[model samples]
Structures are given as structure tokens and as C-alpha cells.
Target: MSSYFITGVARGLGFEFVRQLSTNPANTIIGLVRDKTATEKKVSEELSGRKNVHLIQGDMVDYASLKKAVDEIATITGGKLDYVIANAAFLSVWAAFEPFSLLAKEPEKLEKELVDMFTVNVVGNIHLFNLITPLVLKGNGKKIIAISSGLGDQEMAINYELFQNAPYSISKTALDMAVAKFHAEYRKDDVLFMCISPGMVDTGYIDPETALLNDMIGKFMKYAPDFNGPTPIDVAIQRILSVMDKSSVEAGDGGKSLSQFGNKQWL
Candidate 1:
């Protein structure tokens, strides 16, 4: 049985990742969530009678709280994590709404919004990766995966449909660099890590306008055949499983793989 640790387990992609992995008795999943009050109960309700699922309550901002959760999971499971997914993200829809003239807008609101954007989308994620890397080092498996977007690839930026997600795109691009650093630092350990772009999943976290625009451009981008495509939560979980299966891991190094029409890409 393989064990995995994941953050942002409250809803959307994180919840889906937990759901997909919990179905198998042999797979153990430790999920970290922010909404301590409700998410835990909902997870219990949504996934009842599953002994393999372990829920940890916390957020990416507070290291002490997050570390406690990590320690508990490690102690309980005996530190056998096969994969550590830094999937907890900080994102705000307002980042994409920037106009040609920020000087015309209310400076306070705009400033607050952008600060919130950087705090969550960028800073919080860096904290998450830094907090969990040691656990990944202590774990048994040789895999670490970070959730990223195609827009993060600077070389392919113009070719992507990143919208106006300045903070998100920039943060993810930074995250890719962090993953590369980890890979380089641990080169002799025989471990593999990758930052993956999971496609335009409907996680319901995006702005309605952004979603509509993305969908309109989806045709040009060669969206999945079903058109309806996979929801953010569902596709995220499926991709994790697909990537973990040894048959899918023919190449030992878990380099960057992007998914568009359910097929993996290297970029």
C-alpha cells in the first residue's frame, strides 16, 4: 500500500484527490484542510466507512498548525508517504480583472485585492512547499508532485491562454523553479518530482467571465472530446492516480507533464 500527503482538501481538486485515493484500501491519504469547522464533517459524510482516509485540519498560512497536522499524520502512519502534493493554492478571481488603467480605480480596494492575491496564490504556496519538503524527504516513496498551470511555462507563455492571471501565472512559474531546485538538490536520491498542468478543470473557483472566456477559447486550444470535460475535482484525482500507476510511470523521472485532452505532454 502506498501512502500520500496532500493539502487543500476542503473542496474542488483537493477533495477530489482525497476521494479518488480513498477508494482503494491499500492507498492511505492524509488530507490537510483550512475550514476546520465544516470540511472535516463533510469529508466524513461524503466518505464514510473508509478507514484509509485520515483528515487533518489546518491551512497553509500557519506553519505551526500545519506542522502539527503533519506531525500527527507522520506519527500515526509511521512516515511512509509515497507522494507529497503541494496542492493547496491561494487564488483570487480579482487578479484577472485588472484594467488598462489601475490609476482610475479605488487605490485601496485594488491594493487590498492584489495583496490578497499574492498572499494566497504565491506566498502561501511557497510556505506549503517549504513546510512539506522535509516530510517528503522522510517518506518512503520517490515522488513529489505540485499542481501547476500551463501558463507557468514562461517560454510558452504567449502560446497559452492564461487570461490576465498575473499573480497566478507568475506564482506557478516560481513554483516550477522551486520544484526544479528540489530535483537538483536531491539528484542523488533517486527521487522524481514534477509540476503538472491539469487542464481547464471546472473547479468553480474561477470568475464567471474568466470561465466563459476560457471556454470560448477552449475550442482553439483543442479541448477534450466530451466537451463537458472533467470537473476540477474529478480530473485532479484521476490524474493523480493515473500518474502514480507504475504503468504510467515508464520514465522514472517525473518530469513536467501537461494534460490537455487526457493525454500527457512534456514542456
Candidate 2:
């Protein structure tokens, strides 16, 4: 049975990954969330009675907690993990384009925001790879997928002149580099490391109550007039997983930062 471990499986793309992957009876899926109690309702409603799915409590920002959860999974999965999807990330805190830019001008606040963003988005993901690499090495399908964003593409950012969501974008760029570096070092072992951007996905992480969201959407719409909004999470997840299923070192997917279209377009 293929064994998969994913982080941030409370409500968004992470939850969809667990749900979709567990559909196969031959697959064992382990889901990680910051708080199991907090996610109980969603888990029960969306993933109830799935014998292949297991829930684990952990936060990406806390390496110790993640380590403990990995230990628990090791015991449960017999020390092998086929896929480690680094999907947990922190972004909503300092996401607004203008406000985040203004906030970045402040020395102390900027440091805190940058550190928090990098810690959860970049450092934590790399740390997860460190902890799970051995388990992945033991599995039949050795794939480490980092959930990145098209906003991380520097070329696209320059072309679009997009400067909003700077903190999240910067962190994702670093994450993509880390995934590529990991692939460079581990491809010899037949361990595949890839990063894929899910494009614009509507997971309801954006608060409709926030006045700035409309402005942000307006700004986004300028580039692509056809850009209505994010795609449904399930639709995005299915497309992403299809790409992952077809990826391999032989197909030149290893060490690549791919987009939802399965190309280097970044989106």
C-alpha cells in the first residue's frame, strides 16, 4: 500500500489531498494539523470512517511537535513513508499588498513578520524533509512534494510588476529552491523532489469580510481580465495530483519547479 503524509490537512488543499489519496484502499494516508480537536468536525464530516486515513496533531512551525508526530507515524506505518507533502504554510497574517509593504518599512515589525513567514514556510518545510527523508528512502515511491505558488516565480513577478504579498512570495521562492537543492542531492538515490504551484485556488482562506480583499482581487484582475477568482480546491487538487502521479526523474520532472499546467510557466 502506498503511504502518504501531508501537513495542514484541516480544511483547504491539504484536506483535499488526504481525502483524494485515501480513496484508494491500497493507500494509507496520514494527515497532520495544528490541533486535532479543532479539526474534529471537518475530519468527521469530510473524512469519516476512512480506514486508510489517520489524523496526527502537529504544527509546521514547531519542529519538536512535527518530530513527535513523525515518530508516531513511523510506528504506525512500519517506518516507511512514500510521499511527504509539505503543504502547511503561514500566509494570512501579512498578506495584503500595500499594508504588508508599509509594515515592512518598520524595522522591528518587519523582522518579526519575515521571521515568522520564513520559519513556517521555508525552514519548517526543509526540516520536515530532514526528518522524513529516511522514511521516504525506505518506501517504494520516494517523492517529496513542496506546495509552492506561482507568485514565487521571479520572472513572472517582474513581468507582472507584482509586489504585493511580498512576504509569502519571498518565502515560497526560498522553498522552491530548497526543494530543487534536495532533488540535486537525493536524485541519485531515486528519491524525487519536486515543487508544484496549485495556481489560484479558492480554499476560503481569504476573508470576504476584509475590505482589502476586493482591492487585491481588483489588482489581480488587471493582468488577466478573465481572472474571475480562485478555482475550487478539489478541482485544483485533482489536477495537481495528476501531475504528481506522472512525475519522475526520467521524465525530467525531478528537481523541477512545475506549475499547475505541468510546465515551467509557474501557473
Candidate 3:
């Protein structure tokens, strides 16, 4: 049996990934979520009859909790991790509301916003990967994938005003840089680094039927074309899992950059 790991399983896209992996007959899926009580309740109820799923507790902001989860997963899965996914990220990129309205204004907001953004998006991924790679290395294969956003792209964001959220974009860009760095550092380990944009998915972050719906719809579409095109999270999850199964890596592997729809050019 192949082993795989995913973070941020509380709801939205994360929850969808968990459901697909759990119901599938071929995969061994270990999913991590922030609230053990709530996530566990939901997962327990959902997968009560399933034998392929394992739900673990974790917090993106807490490194120790992440490490503990990593340790347990390594032990439970017998150190055979075929794919490790860094999927947890901030709900949105921008942090501050006033004084620095994605345009310009304050030193304090800039610092605070970017710090939090990077901490969750960049640092969270980094810490989790650092913990998981050893298990993957000890096992049979090595591949790492992270959920990425268009806001992180310099070339894409330059043309789109909707994606120009200061810290959110910066965090994602930083995440891209981290992926590149990990690819290089672990190339000898034969790790294929991958990223997915997930196409403006509407994981129900904001209600669509609420007032100002037209303006909100326009904004979401303008910013995230994927939000309108919105692939159901389960579809994206299956594709990602397929990518994990088909991808190859010899010791010291590289050149494995990709985006949401499996487009090699986006990275």
C-alpha cells in the first residue's frame, strides 16, 4: 500500500480531498486538520466504515504539534511515504484592512501582515515538509507537492489587479521560492517538487447568495478565474493523487514544477 499525507483538512478544499481519499479503495491517506475535536468528529462520522483513512490532529501555526503528527504518521505508515502534500494555507493573502489597502500606507501593517502570511503559507509548509521528508526518504519514493496561488506569480500578477494582494502574493511567491530551493536541496534524494494553483476554487470561503452578490461575483471572477471555473475540490484531489502515483524520481531528482491544472508552464 502507498502512503500519502495532507494538511488543512478542516473544511473547504481540504475536506474534499479527505473525502475522496477516504472513499477510494486504492490509497492509504493520512489527513491532518487543526481542530482535533471538530475535525475528528466530522471525520469519524464520515469514515466510520472506511478502513483506508487515518485522521490526525495538527495546527499549522504550531511546529511542535506538526512534528508530533509527523512522528505518528511515520510510525503508523511504517515510514513508506510515496507523496507528501503541503496543502494548508491562509484563507486569503491580504491581512491588514486599513492604512495599507493593498495600495500603500503603513510600516506596522506591512510587517505584521507579511510576517503572518509567510508564517502560515511559507513557514507552515516548510516546517511540515522538514518533518515529513525523512519518513519519505526512509520509505520507497520521494515527492512533495504544495497548493500554490496565482497571487504568487510575478508574471501573472503583473497583469491582474485582483491578485495584487500585498502579503498574500508575497507569501505565495515565497512558497514558490521555497519549492525551488527544496528541489535543489533534495535533488540528490530524488524528490519531485510539485505545486498546484487549484484554479480559483470556491471552497465556500464567502457566501455567494449574500447581498452585493453581483459585485462580489465580479471581483472573485476577475481575481481568480478558477473561482468561476471552480473545479470541485474532489476532482483536483484525484488528479493530484494520480500525479503522485505516476511521477518518478531517482535519487537526486529535479525539474518537477507544476501548477493547479497540471500545467508545467505555470510554474
Against the hidden reference, what TM-scores do the models get? 0.80, 0.92, 0.82
- Model 3 / residue 164 / CA error / Å: 3.7
**RMSD to true structure for each model, in Å:** 3.8, 2.0, 3.7
> Local error of candidate 2 at 77, Å?
1.2
Task: Check candidate 2 and list the clashing pairs.
Answer: none
Candidate 3 residue 237 C-alpha distance from true site, Å: 2.4
Q: Which candidate number has the best TM-score?
A: 2
lDDT of 1: 0.66
Q: What is the C-alpha lDDT of each candidate?
A: 0.66, 0.84, 0.70
* Candidate 3 lDDT tens digits, 1-267: 567788887887777777876676677888888777887778778767767777788888899999999988978887568777788887642441222354346568678777888899999898888888888887665778887776567766555444335577788888888888887788777778766666556577645564534543465565555565456667766766666556555522243445554554332
Note the clash tally of each candidate.
Answer: 1, 0, 9
- Report model 3's TM-score to 2 decimal places: 0.82
State in Å the error of residue 199, model 2.
Answer: 0.8
**Best first by lDDT, ranked:** 2, 3, 1
lDDT of candidate 1 over 151-252, digit per residue (tens): 565544455433455556677777777667766766566556667666657788655565545543464244334545434557556765575454223364
**Which scores higher on lDDT, 2 or 3?**
2
